[model samples]
Target: MPTLTIRNLDDRLKQRLRLRAAQHGWSMEQEARVILAQVLETPAQNDGAAWLQRVRQRFQGVAGDDWQPSDRREGTERELPHFDP
Candidate 1:
């Protein structure tokens, strides 16, 4: 594994990390690794539009406020499903 050196980390932040490490029965380094792993496992959702686009792509033909009947030529639409955070 590659080595990582954190320079000029805040004293209070370091203290908090130490306490968290102790509470989890892990070394500060191990705690940091676990935190990083958990965070990176999820895709970032900072962009609402982009997140909505992904949902549409994943559920294509099943969602969107612009949905229409395959046989209909008129501009009919339906409400997209509500998603909770």
Candidate 2:
């Protein structure tokens, strides 16, 4: 196991951490370890593909089995106006 030290942490923040640790029935060090593990183990959602995947996963099967796509196509192209170039 390795030892980690945080230098010059705010007194108020440390006090709050201590209170939280006591509330959760853990020591300050143990609570810090738990917090670090939780925050560090989670995957990042910053990538566009990752975000899209999460969105798809959340709404999976939300449309039900009866959903169908409409057959739509682009409209006819319009002629460009004559310009004196």
Candidate 3:
């Protein structure tokens, strides 16, 4: 068993923690332990690029040439003016 000491806890925060613990039918220490356990046990997705790539790969075959804007000839393409100033 390990011992943990928390210091400088505000009175208002301690009161809120006590209320939350009571709501869940747990002591303040037990509630804190449960929260710590849950937070530590969960795995986080840290790679945004990898997630985006996976999503793009999943829906890769859904679109076709018929859905492209160039496929539909509505009018002549006008290029936007490039401002250098």
Give TM per candidate: 0.56, 0.59, 0.54
Higher-ranked by lDDT: 1 or 3 = 1
Q: Comparing candidate 1 with candidate 2, which one achieves the higher TM-score?
A: 2
- lDDT tens per residue, model 2, 20-65: 9999999999999999999888887687989999999999879677
Residues 1-85, model 1: lDDT tens digits: 8988999999999999999999999999999998888899867777798889888889887645776657675567777999999
Which stretches of model 1 miss by more than 4 angstroms? 47-50, 53-85
lDDT of 3 by residue, 1-85 (tens): 9899999999998898899999999999998898889988876555687788888999898866567455455676789999998
Ten-residue region with minimum lDDT total, candidate 3: 65-74
Cα deviation at 69, candidate 2, in Å, is 20
Models ranked on TM-score:
2, 1, 3
Best by lDDT: 2
| By lDDT: ranked, best first | 2, 1, 3
What is the Cα-based lDDT of residue 35 in candidate 3?
84
lDDT of 2: 0.90
Query: What are the clash counts of all predictions, listed in order?
Result: 0, 0, 0
Q: In order, what lDDT does every prediction score?
A: 0.88, 0.90, 0.85
Model 3 ranges off by over 4 Å: 45-85
